[model samples]
Target: MRAGNVKRGVVGLVAGVVFAGLTTFSGASAETGGCGLVGTVGTPEIGVDDTNAGLETLPAAEIALPEQIYFRTSTESFNRRWSFAARDGRIYVKEAAAQGGWRSLPLPGCMEGRIAGVSADDDEVMAIDRDGWFFTMDHALSAPKDWNWSTRYGTPLWTGAGNTLPAGTLDWTWSVLSPNEDHVWRDTAGNDHPVGGAKVSHVFALVDGGCRIAYVDPWLPVDHSYELATPANGRFRAVKLSTSASTTLVVNRFGDLYTRLYDFDISGADKVFFRYSYEDQRGLREAPDMLSERVDSGTAAIQLPAPDWVRQPKVPGEITDRISVHKTGIGSDARELRIEGESGGRTGYWVKQLTDAAWRFVATDQPLAGTRLENTAADHSIDESIQPSPYSYAGRSAAGWTATVANFDISNTPTTLRVDVGNGERLDLILHMVDGLRQLPQQRGIGTQARRFDGTVEVPGDILGSLATQPDSIRQFVTSTLGGRRFTDTAVDVTVREFRIDGLSVTLGRS
Candidate 1:
């Protein structure tokens, strides 16, 4: 077998394992310039939602927030989310809860420009402004009074080497690439070399003029930067490839898209190498039949290019219309595969293995908009639907009354309530209450009889606004209906429900 073909075959296998979401990186060699990479896939957080202030003068920089952030010590826990953005000549860190609102960090005057490629983890955060300057912070806040901002390492534990571009580096930089960990760099008298040796993670400097798309990994030689053809007048702005797997999806400044099959070898314990399984640049739009017919009809989006091991079959009808696959969650333990579709005037979702060509139906009363095959030991998965109250709300009332509310929407329509009020008394009640809907009708004393209240009561505003207007309504209702049955505990538990799969949190014990 030809050496090139053999390398392709190996990479193809790795791609299959990555997209399959089945393998662990135990005993595998770690590649330099690849610390952020998970076992087969890095956390796939999409960043196509940032609003750009102006037109395409520079390449759009992208950054994704990690699933969780942890400090060195458990001094405090930040259950609330944190996000970073560059605007108005400053970098702002905003928490989900408006504790401090959006506050600016004390960025050194030198590192002032349009920020691109912002990445943060438990220990540190790194950002590169448009001018090719980088900044790092140990804590995600401004420098303290009389504190040294110049000495602050922009990226905690970052190998400060290779961060600053040499004098001959590009005059204007498009964006900075933020890898999960520091990349190892070798600068032999300004001639970059990836010569095989002990590799350390470090940053690569991209200049204005360059014709190479080089990365040291599974198969490429470390001696030189692999040169690739660029489109006419196309200046390289941003190049974000999937580090999670051996898949290559590159979008140029001209919006020209390309994909390649890349693979690496870590069999030589502590020594890793990478090569292109299929080195040919496969133009996605030109390559017909690479995806399902949905690709041509625009019904589906490409989530991940089919790995070589799981490429589309030549013959149709074998594996017909397939919805787009979406990568969800973070890290090895949190990664999930999901697919969504619309059929028969209803939206549906399915969970299928990366190796499985066919989609398996996910059973649900209402058609699910999407479903994620969570990476867990148990059969746990996240299901998405458009309908309000994807899951029934079951909680104990202040008086220890347990009930379940279904089809509930605090802002809109009424919901069906099944209440189980127990305290040496039994009252079975079914309620269909809506906004502004009042159930303060003539009440009956505690009895063994079953009664149902079906009426349109005005809840006025949203669940919070309406409830806030009448804070003691629940207690009042309970007391009035039960002839002065008062709540023993005055504290009310409030929980803010997060809808996003990755951001899902059910925090309790708040009054």
Candidate 2:
């Protein structure tokens, strides 16, 4: 993929991974008989893909005036999905699963010419004008013309005419509004003619994965083109989806549906990703507990699937460097885990929660040496193909113990040594802790105080008991002891002020 612009990265932490095609998306509904289904905080009033009642339900007959099709679930009872189309300055609602012509609402001053784009949920309806001013009306006979026009000063204009309208409603839902400029005109003979006719100029709705049309000339059934621009809602990937010129649609390296005809049946409800959900909670209307929220509902989870190493089984010695917990929703009770590391080899470590009873290994049986990496500060160039490497604990130690580990990097949780070993292996592991893993103190300090750690030691008898074992045993013993405590890279001055391994003093630093 060609690098367009660097975007923000989301962190996820999970074990199992699931992948499914993005089928249909629906906005949440409010209380019973309210504008819940159609009115989201930041979305357009649209319908979701209910495979039971697919897009084929939309009338195949071509519409005379400009129209946009979307879905809306009713709060009447069993949130029935209704196919809505804003056509010829009128809002038409029909059950997507059922047959019959669309039922038009009482347009009053809209049907003749006033309303350009409109969306409705249940009885609540919204309308836009040529100048981008907004107004709302309820179809309930009780409050006939309860028109509530917008008081906001932001005047939205034609899609490609250097002016912009609010991309979506404050309900966090998608919308379908026409531009101020007319792309279609009719002669006295009643023959519809396209203005600047080669291609059609269309309005765009920047959605989660890509962009879609909000408005297209009904007369011009030809290809609808668009330019790219950041929408008013800055959270979406498309900072902009405007037309480069007046009528030409620019195609990005990623082929979105903007280059095709603005057909909702074919494109589905292609609007902005609904930011409102049980977890994200940005909806204007209270979300009813209908179905479980979308899988991409949480902010902590990644939109895509996990990497190959995460899904595939581990191999012996093969270094499965670092595994990032990109997904959210980890239960609070899960304190200890056995994440498989490399496939096989004399490399691996264990993480035993001091509170937990048993010790478990992650990858190989042999303890792997950790590394002390120092980066040379230098400027780098951004490339299309390059991606930042995930954090890893696979490097060399200074003492030549073929193991590698880095201090804790929370963004990508690397493996940590947990179990204890009998020989010097465990000790050598503790030494790595001196680098980056420093546990923070609970008590508040006056300023940023560099902490000093002092812990008592007991040399094992196997290393010092016999002269024959002392030489080789001492070296091995130190390696294991230091390696085991390599949990933090804190500058710990491990001074032998009073060395007593099992209460025996070693004649080293006795000044």
Best by TM-score: 1
TM-score of each: 0.26, 0.22
Q: Could you give candidate 2's per-residue lDDT for residues 175-210 as a string of tens digits?
A: 121111232322222222222112122223443233
Model 1 bad stretches (over 4 Å): 1-80, 96-101, 112-117, 121-123, 139-511
Question: Residue 132 in candidate 2 has what lDDT?
Answer: 45
Q: lDDT of all predictions, in order shown?
A: 0.27, 0.25
Q: How close is candidate 2 to the true structure, as a TM-score?
A: 0.22
Each prediction's RMSD over C-alphas, in Å, is: 28.4, 26.0
| Regions of model 2 farther than 4 Å from truth | 1-81, 121-123, 139-511
Residue-by-residue lDDT tens digits, candidate 1, 368-434: 3222222222221111212233334555555465555544332222234344555433332333221
